[model samples]
Target chain A: MLPTLPLGPFIFPTAGLVIIFGAWFCLWVIEKAALRLQLDAQATYTLAVVGLFAGFLGARLAFVALHWPAYQQNLIGILWPLTSGYAPLGGLATGIVAAFFYGRARQLPFAATLDALTPGLILGLMVISLADFLGGPGYGTLTAVPWGLSQYGVRRHPVQLYELLAGALTLLVWWRLVRGRRYDGQLFLTAVAVYSATRLFLDAFRDNTWIITNGYHGWQLVAFAALLLSLLLLARHDGNQ
Target chain B: MLRTRFEWVILIIVATLLGSAWIMMSQEPATAGSSLLTLAEAPIVGHPAPNFTLPGTVGQEVSLHDLAGQPVVLNFWATWCAPCRVEMPAFQQASVQYNGRAAIIGINQGEAAKNVTDFGAEYRITYPLLLDTDQQISRLYEVRGLPTTLFIDADGVVREVVIGAITPAVLQDRIERLLAEAGNP
Candidate 1:
């Protein structure tokens, strides 16, 4: 796997590079979408930056708190990044909270802001899937198909590529639906529904899922919940209209 | 105009899909036919353990070949590794519990003998601690990270490999599995 890329004397992790590029591209797309929607692009940019910083800090602090005994023994080890101690759930929750405050402080309409951000979010997901495919992290279950990739010396489904394809299709659907949309929050809800539905189906093929119990993935449950919430919101918006 | 924009979006999406599929198919398989096998290889799990001789803390050279017919727990650790220190007592306990039935060898990676000796004393480690000063043995076993433990059967086949700090219960379970694989009651 292309885990690391060598540039002269320096070594860079391909996954990290892909994620950085993804964030940059996502911000650029968000800025464009904000401009098109007549929202404050600068404020949107600030919100994204603040949310990312808060998320990173929250995840790191949560990780250190979990490994407090080890950090107590060697305080310097707390500074180490890329350790297998991150709490993604904590980061996600912190990011959403940060974004909400930033949005409120900027006096931006929540529905319009979410609609503007949907495309970039889908694109970012696609980039993450690409990174996963290259970095060999989120591998798939064993398969005998011709396109099955060799992971851990066995032919496995390229689930990351599957995710990428799903993300792309979701983005396209969002773009099509955004044109002449009747409701303010329709695009956002539709985007969420498409993305969550895609993830709910594709997560079944993932081998490294966080299983809750009885072979059910925690992420799959989350996806199903998100999908239902999106559908409910869509229906409510339509009824109001 | 909306229909035209929708058509463009569909066309671009199709093109992007075709391009990505082509790139994925054209590129070389990430792990295809590599000469070196990763540590997760199932075939290597049942294969003979790579033999190595290294200087031990007991003031003698210890070789894997010498421990024939005895299930061995080969632990790769370092003095500075927190997980290694955390699991040292469990390893020591396991060593004592299986005193005659199995042999536990701790391979210290590229560390000074004095440091390892001091750490061992602090942890009260009763197992043999071997020093891989040049990391020759670590490289051979593809030990990329600290605190990797390999459970080897009596016939010298590696039965299981644990990549992180293992609890005493897990260690005991793996040892029992290794012994079972070796046909020992």
Candidate 2:
């Protein structure tokens, strides 16, 4: 179902289109954030360009690492994102880290920039989840729940939609805070905490439950930790003001 | 302390992202496309089969596993897949020829039970029907196009996976090689 990347001998997925949409939307949000914060809009645009490239590279690299054995035999296939795989988390991670380092190299305030970019980041994640649902991968377990999707022939939990809805709600919260809240980075903290908490619960219905501690991953625990730490940072940032 | 805090935050984010990436990567099967021959690697012959399970008309559960310990022939058909209706007689013929040596499992991808059952009855298909209800099995095996056939070995390792429509001769030749490998005396 829209598996490969490209059109004919190649297959470019509608899913990739969604990913670009997410990135562009994030860039637009970043521009807005920069204007509101009185930061240079040029810096935001630079970050977006660099971050997008870095994110693509990072996502591909992460996919290759995870599926090294498969890619090893088919070296040429690695060039195509559809042939290999795509990891949103990996892309986001690499993008943010790259952007941070790039911003630092340019002598920009990394924390302040990150604060402005948070809502956009959340929105990007939500959009990607929606794409995943459309592509028929990254879905959760099967169930008899009324809302369960009848994919193929059996009823399955619409885990992708759950994540999407959760993401939308998180975005709404972030949007509200960014629009009206007095605190800088408050929306960022709320986005992190809300998304992390939703992800933790939604992961239950996911078919690929990476068993770590009590059926969770080390990453989720870290997300929980981030939620706590970010809240504290927001408090401190507010205190400074 | 300030620098340390920043480093910790970055490290945490990187680690989480890596972890999520790993999960997505693991979703693809490792044993895909390791077949020896080039012609065998064609999407029609070498691609992965749509994995599924269905309840036999007799009420006992039959699945891809039920055909294990013998070379298994998996055929995905539907009343709608034009080629599927045409391929039924060929499969029926092969089933009779390969009886007791290897089992033939017909998996219905995206077809309702009533439609599949009626189609099976119309074609006089004697083999067991497996339901890939949610297409979980289909997703697992990477079945893109319809009318797929997978040739699984006695050990449940796929010897060859076929996609698209198949003929009686093609099905029989493949079955003969598998039966020969099993040392059928």
Every model's DockQ, to 2 decimals?
0.08, 0.04
**DockQ top scorer:** 1
TM-score of 1: 0.65
Residue A183 in model 2: shift from native, Å? 4.5
Docking band of candidate 1: incorrect
CA lDDT for candidate 1: 0.74
After superposition, the stretches of candidate 2 with alpha carbons farther than 4 Å from their true spots are A1-12, A61-82, A85-93, A142-144, A152-154, A179-183, A217-219, A238-241, B1-185
Q: Spell out the clash pairs found in candidate 2.
A: A4-A11, A5-A11, A5-A12, A6-A11, A6-A12, A153-B133, A154-B133, A154-B134, B53-B131, B54-B131
Instruction: Give model 2 RMSD, 1 decimal.
Output: 13.5
Q: What is the TM-score of chain A in candidate 1?
A: 0.92
lDDT agreement with native, every candidate? 0.74, 0.66
Worst 10 residues of 2 chain B by lDDT: B38-47
Task: List candidate 1 stretches off by more than 4 Å.
Answer: A73-75, A81-84, B1-185
What DockQ does candidate 1 score? 0.08
